[model samples]
Target: MSGRIPRQFIDDLLVRVDIVDLIDSHVPLKKTGSNFVARCPFHTEKTPSFSVSRGKQMYHCFGCGASGNAISFLMDYSHLGFVEAVEDLAAFVGVDVPREIGGDFSASDKEDFTRLYAVLEDVAAFYVDQLRTGDGRIAVDYLKARGVSGEVARDFGLGYAPQAWDVLLGRFERDALIDAGMLVVREDGKVYDRFRGRLMFPIRDKRKRVIGFGGRVLDDSLPKYLNSPETAIFSKGKELYGLCELLQKKSRPERILIVEGYMDVIALAQYGVANVVATLGTATSKTQIDMLFRYASELVFCFDGDNAGRQAAWKAVDAALSCLRDGRQIKIMLLPQGHDPDSLIRDEGKAGFEQRIEQAQVLSDYFFDFLAGPLNLSSIEGRSQLMTAARPQVEKIPPGYFKDMMWRRLRELAGSRVVELPEKPSTLNRQFQGKVGKAKTQRPSLGRRVLALLIQRPELAQVLAQRHLSLEGLKFAGQELLEDVLRRIALEKPENGAILLEAYRGSSYEKTVNALAGVELDIPEGGEEAEFFGAVIQLLKQSRQEKLTELLAKEGREGLNAEEKQVLRALLRERL
Candidate 1:
């Protein structure tokens, strides 16, 4: 059980696991042209905005900003850590994760995760075994009473925790229970079971490894449900119940419905709503929402009718707005009065509950009409308050045509004759003005121009360096970045930008690499290159003079350091 998984093993595993097949599991990808096309799972869209290039082994979503290789997609979509994602991918191709050369598990940082997985599996088996016993009959009866079928219970990995706390604590050592995050020990040295007298629901990762558990009390208890605390293997914020089974099915859900409790999820699935999942008694996070977007074209939030539910919906809406792009859509379904999903399924039946889903309001409609309703547009003060409240939400939206439409909608809502408020600034117009002003004020520095030229045609590197081209005059924070590039070129004698990037593999200059690699250099025509070279030399000379002047001012003639004196003499000599 050594930690280090060999790099070649991971690469071979990736080769075995077809990228297209892996991506297809999460999204409904149709063959389009040379690549596969699917409605971007990262955003809600009617038309396809996501494309997977099989040849390139990359996927990009045009609607949302999700672009990544196979590993990245798995990590983001499955909410798995880098190592966990690799292991999951490896498992899919039926390759064993390679162990380190030695018995030491420190080689790969995944040893803790691997051990946790083992512990969770053991706990799941214990729970399952307990559920089959006579004591488990109470848990089964409770589930049946709540309309959870045997199939649904099995599908969800439902089990039973005995009423006595020590029943579980006695089975495992204190360290083992603590490692599993199944027991909490008080300051008095008393160890207490995290879940007792409750129905156990195994929390699984995308690869279907039970990483944690959630337990619901069979009867009246202070806290109805208790979830496993965050452990090395479990993050409550990033996990979604039922995602593993849904992904395995490879059926793209039209819309993902997010609910609050585990019972709600079990209840929905029991009633044939297999696409529904519930947060682990926590607020919806951007990470969870992002994971949902990977498998679903649209998202519908089903919250309770109470004030708490309304507040949760608002938080979800705001979170979605921050992460969701133009093509993605989000809808909100507020359950009818005094109805939880568990109660609703029992009361109204599946079809009746679906009708409520059909009536779910789009995010735009919810924002403009429902959520923003408290602000009165009849009064001037009310109009001002509405605009103030709306600005921050609107600002959260990335700059684009969609933001413009939203601004116009806001102005129309707040500035109409009923309210007759001032017209809001157009996002596009402001962006255009800012771009023009920036272009006018900021001229490209000689150092930047030289670096760009070198990056575009590294043959120019020798010519530029031979002329003693210095980047000291550049008015940019990318000074150290340019220096790193120059150092790489000097050390490696790279014939091109690509070679230079390869040579500086572990350098802290990746931002420079990205900029240089992604951007097209504007090489001027005719004598412009010579003119640029001359300007660079002149700037360097001027910068040298300024350095000398500063040194002289700081340290008088009598107090002049050797380096300072030599630098002063060099500047004067250069001038002469």
Candidate 2:
């Protein structure tokens, strides 16, 4: 694989994958006027505050500060790296991601990893074919005995890898299988299939492309289930077992059920409760949580009713703090002792299993419950300890009613203890993002205004440049960033916010671009262009003042040269 992914692949992938189509596949959106609207998945909320623009091909949460384009959304939601997200997007849109390998392109270097994806799919088909062979009866009986109907088995892409050491070697190239994660090679040069003697589950991305596999041994084994190692297309921490099928449901599922095992997810599907997914031999990751939020507003984690399980749930609580936006719900369902989703659903059926879901503890209740478990909240020292532990987590949440509510709950737990709350963090670093739109700071500075205008109407960059304008001598806080933008604008001349944002992907000013791109400025409706020019004029005025200051400082420090004195006199002759 090439080390550096070309920018052209990213741009092409963005064009092929529409932002609305990508986000709506996860978050159920309703057509609202010209755009789509859904409750923001970033924070907890009661109404729709998230909006997707088909025109701009971007999304923004009016409630919390979360905002991005299609590629960024996948990175944040799926917890994928930049290259991984690009590959996944390209696969979704049926394009080949051309990676630029060392200098010029050769035929081998230009080959996209799509071929590896194809190999995995073929391997999945072979495993499914194996399940029907005479030697595969044990695997078939195992599924049938576990109550997996043939239709459900087919629905989940379940299969069985043959017990023979060289079963796959005869039909496929060993190196291709290795790259696709279907085979393992030893240092001694011995190579074998990775899933021999095991029932197979093909792990796919949201696009329904088979990327890797998970296998469970039928006999007594040290490790009961083994998943494919991370390949170009698969990251175990980022995928959920049944989400691809769950997303295809007609009525969007209101809450997603997260469990620990593949059978747990498949078993739930068998019982007609299909909103469940399984993490692949890992903890509930932040990417997993964020991805779950894309499909539903609420998530209920099904764990065993044991101390160990409670500890795991608490870990989930800690991981979820950073991603918890207002309007989203997270809960913990500790199943009765000695019962897992698979066994419990088999014993009590779907209704009984859902009863436990209904009774699961809300995140806030669990948050305090878990923290207060070791500390005595009744004592003053214990209260101080509790506050000390909870303050940092409370501050991490995005500004919303949910965060405000958590703070109040913490204060209530502290009884007469003084806890200082930080000032409200806004979506756009100002109070105007709140429902009241009250201005909490002074007027937007010349630097800030120039950034706002360029972000809102990106084409204005070309107009500003055509007029022979630049940041020049402006020395405000974001002046350096403004100059960078101006240079890229003059060189690349991107047309929209999405393209403009892409221009600064790995630049130091990425966060600033993200913040500026998503913010809806308070400029007057009809006079956007005029307002931008006006801001530019103010910025230039500040640049002139900055120049004047520099000249005066130079003269103060040492006697000015004759040319400097002439320039100073000319500048001072002009009226302020």
Candidate 3:
């Protein structure tokens, strides 16, 4: 609990948890050939683009470019953080995660957050208790008037704060409540409840643990929303209201709606629209947007159709551009004047509200439209102005089809004044243009093939060591990585690809090793050993040829030493 999870533990955990079994339990994989296949859970695809390799203990999505080991799969599929995902996997395999001596977490850091989470949970329970007790009827009646049902209220853990200042102060420890952001200490040496006479919305993380609270006054009051102060466990910019509830309703929603307030989220959910989350009194951050995309592919930011709403939506766009990928989408939906999501949902009903969602302007369209505000695009000067304003933001988009299409749209809008952009990289199309029609005649280099084969079946390392050959002087692009893999395989004797790659995690070779783990080698089944030895022999011979040529050149320049002469003689006698 004090330090990072030991790498050895993680490697062992990967060995215990079979990738095929783990993914099958979640995604219902079908055996297509040697590996299992499923429709990718990360994106919407008709074809089964997701593959789980039993031999490698890895999953890769051909359509969306999602690939990783078991820990990564949980992080994406369950929306859990890294530690949480590791813990989940460990629990599945019935092992406890061990911590190293020096890691990101200290003992106090671990204990403090544990206590903070517990105190927050207690505080939330106390507030929820207040909702059902005396004077709770006002809060309950307020919710009823807003058409919030009992079930939805309970589902979201809606609560109430009594008007008294000492309610929570007297119940929980002073220091713990203050640390939890429940009790505030003023400069005058007075402590009071942070939320009073308000409806409380407990903000929980993806793990469904309360981290903070958002309090809304029942009647019209200054500062209509008073949120929990930034604490160790809570950052308003990184948290979203109703997200845990949304995930509970559907583990993976087709689309997620973003609103401005807690009531909007609650009201929408009351109207049978369950896939909505609200920004907690701050502009949406990239962290929140990334978190949202983990649960849904599409996001609709629903704001009031006022100048302020447009301003907020624009800020969201600025935050979202960098997060755009091939399959992800962001849309902006501005409600009618004088109405927010709460009032609009009640007035228009669920069908009408969802219709607005479907009609929301896509981010690309909204982005250009927002940039073209009051600008005469027909005029050269105005088009030039648009190009200048949009170039930097457009470049923030990740390289993919989405970025390419956005560039195309910008060019069409800025026709004569288009700024020359870099030529699109050829690799951008590789994700979409998969190996559907390509012939299998192409093969990677011998070194690369050996690396791929070793990754797919780490036991091949033992087979390789049996040859009693050493690649001590071989020089190639991935020579160092190849040496490292063989060395790790010898030391740890990893049972599969996951355990073998775990040693390379967080190292410079992680991406290369993982890519090799997922590589589709074209060698015939049961021919891995022959191919492996054949490649090894060729590389050794190639290396010897280079050395022989070097020694002969050195002899012509200066006579060779005894060892060098013997090496040259041995190399000359061997068949090329």
Candidate 4:
């Protein structure tokens, strides 16, 4: 709502929302000593790999390389946008999110979203009513024939689009419907209903606001299913149908089932198998996978047995690779030929369906089998081709025992361990590696070390500032940020990292602040004050020596004026 969330409010919010309690509410953590432990929600693993530090108000997962503070955890775990996560954390702690509106800021962006939600709600109700009308009777009959019940249909808010092109034009504003993706306007300037003579399923978000729609024709059609185009309110890739209901379930689900369509989701729910969601006219995307993982530890992707289905499953496998870590599991289940979940559920019923789910192939198993399916393992050339094709995809997965085991299995199948399969870090870990860099385990640079110490023990800023350090002369990668942080602490005197973090809360420096706050320093808790000043003094001495060298060069080459000569004298006069 403004330039940024006030630093004081964020600091206060952090105090109110304990990081442990906040993560535990979503992930169910067990206390062990001073920290809490849980399986990393970001990855698939059998043993717990996630740890939360009580002292630092931070959490890091050893298995998956996920690490962040309370707000970061909320964003990752709850799939909230940064601002949304901040607001959610504040709400969790019973505080309101405070905003600072600069002269250029306005509340219209937030207000526009609120209006869009209202428009979607009205469109959803209109669709629901259309299902019961005379023209919608055909759609009602179609659902009845498919074994969908009135109760279940109403629960899902199933609707019907009348055969007429402009049925909604008289009832609702055309522009609103178009913006909501319910109406289509062609280049020739003709406006008509986007979905016609079809059964409609409203797709809602986690907040239960209708964002989009999925529709299936009542009669035989070339393209059987149609979905709402991307709109201001909807992103096809990020959202899943029936996710709202999945989140609202009273009992925790052991795993989540992702299927192909909206009807598949509703039909499964009708059969009392409710831990299901459907991707909206798209292959499973990484964004959707992350959001789904928030509610369950395992993901079972249901695909058809055909080649197309296998292709889709592989896309999911690829998308899920960066997300896979210890404590999270991904499985692939292919329905029998000619059977989708909709038809299979009708034929096999719940008991038989459960058996098939139990038989779902684990990611490693499916991956190997899929790769081997097109190869002749008995031939050396075939085995070599198989290995070449698979190694790239296998390496995409995070470094773990699972990856190692998969490589071992592949080698065994190829009839050779002659060439060793060296383990590589996962793509996810590579990304995190880029953030922390090689410097994470190595000794930090002088500037970084000083900043880390100042962040951890903000009082060090006062000592450095009291010396009236010449920040302009400092040549470092983060000189400006370090100087700004020191200035804030020296002037405003934010007592700790918690309050210091507030200055960075909604700014570009937030990432740097988080990185510094989480980084481990070798200094003992009681010794940071000395370490801070010591690093700064060393930096100052280095800078003064460099200045003296430069001045000597200038006097030798270009010559120095009286003022420059005075500066050179001062540098020469300084002692270490």
Could you list the CA RMSD of all candidates, in the order they appear?
A: 10.8, 7.4, 5.6, 9.1
lDDT of 1 by residue, 483-515 (tens): 666666676665434344344434554434423
User: Higher TM-score: candidate 1 or 2?
Assistant: 2
TM-score of each: 0.64, 0.70, 0.81, 0.67
Off by over 4 Å in 2: 1-3, 7-112, 179-181, 184-188, 219-222, 250-252, 380-401, 416-418, 426-457, 461-488, 496-498, 504-576
Best by TM-score: 3
Residue 241's lDDT within candidate 1 is: 77
Please provide, for model 3 over 1-576, each residue's C-alpha lDDT reduced to its tens digit, 9 standing for 90 to 100.
336887778877887898888888889999987889999998889999889988678887766667788988898899888788898998888876667766867656767888999988998899889988988889999998878889989999999999998898788888888989888899998899989999999999888999999998988996899999999889898889999888888898999999999988888888899988999888999999998887778999988889999999999999999999888999999989988888887788889988989999999989999999879999989998998898899899988888888777888888953456557765412432233222334566666777778877888776656888777667655566677888888888887777776677677666666666666676677888887888877888877788888999999999899999998888888854
Candidate 3 segments whose C-alpha is farther than 4 A from its true place: 1-6, 15-67, 91-104, 425-449, 462-465, 468-495, 503-531, 534-576
Candidate 4 residue-wise lDDT, 19-129, digit = tens? 888888889999886678999887778999788867666777766566677777877766567777788888788875655776343456555666667777887788789
Task: Determine the C-alpha RMSD for candidate 1 after optimal superposition of all C-alphas.
Answer: 10.8
Model 1 has how many clashing residue pairs? 3
**Model 4 Cα shift for residue 550 (angstroms):** 36
TM-score of 4: 0.67
Arrange candidates by lDDT, highest first: which order? Answer: 3, 2, 4, 1
In angstroms, the error of model 1 at 425 is 15
Range of the 10 consecutive residues with the lowest summed lDDT in candidate 2: 431-440
State the lDDT of candidate 2 residue by residue for 1-576, as single tens digits: 436668766765666678899889878999987779999876679999888877667787766757678888887666456776887788778876675656544556434366787778888898899889976889999999998999999998899988888889889878788888777898998988887889998887776789788899999985899999998768888888888888766234789999989998888999999898898988889988887886678999888889888888988888888888987999999988999899998899889888889988999999998887789887989998988898888887877888888888899998854665557664432322222221313355556667867864677876666777665545666666676777777787565567677777787667667666665655555576777888888877776777777899999998799988986786678534
Residue pairs that clash (backbone atoms under 3 angstroms), model 4: 43-325, 43-328, 44-325, 44-326, 44-327, 44-328, 45-326, 45-327, 45-328
| Candidate achieving the largest lDDT | 3
Model 2 residue 442 lDDT score: 37
lDDT of 4 at 262: 81
Residue runs of model 4 more than 4 Å from their true location after superposition: 1-79, 87-107, 250-252, 416-419, 423-576
**lDDT value, residue 434 of candidate 1:** 33
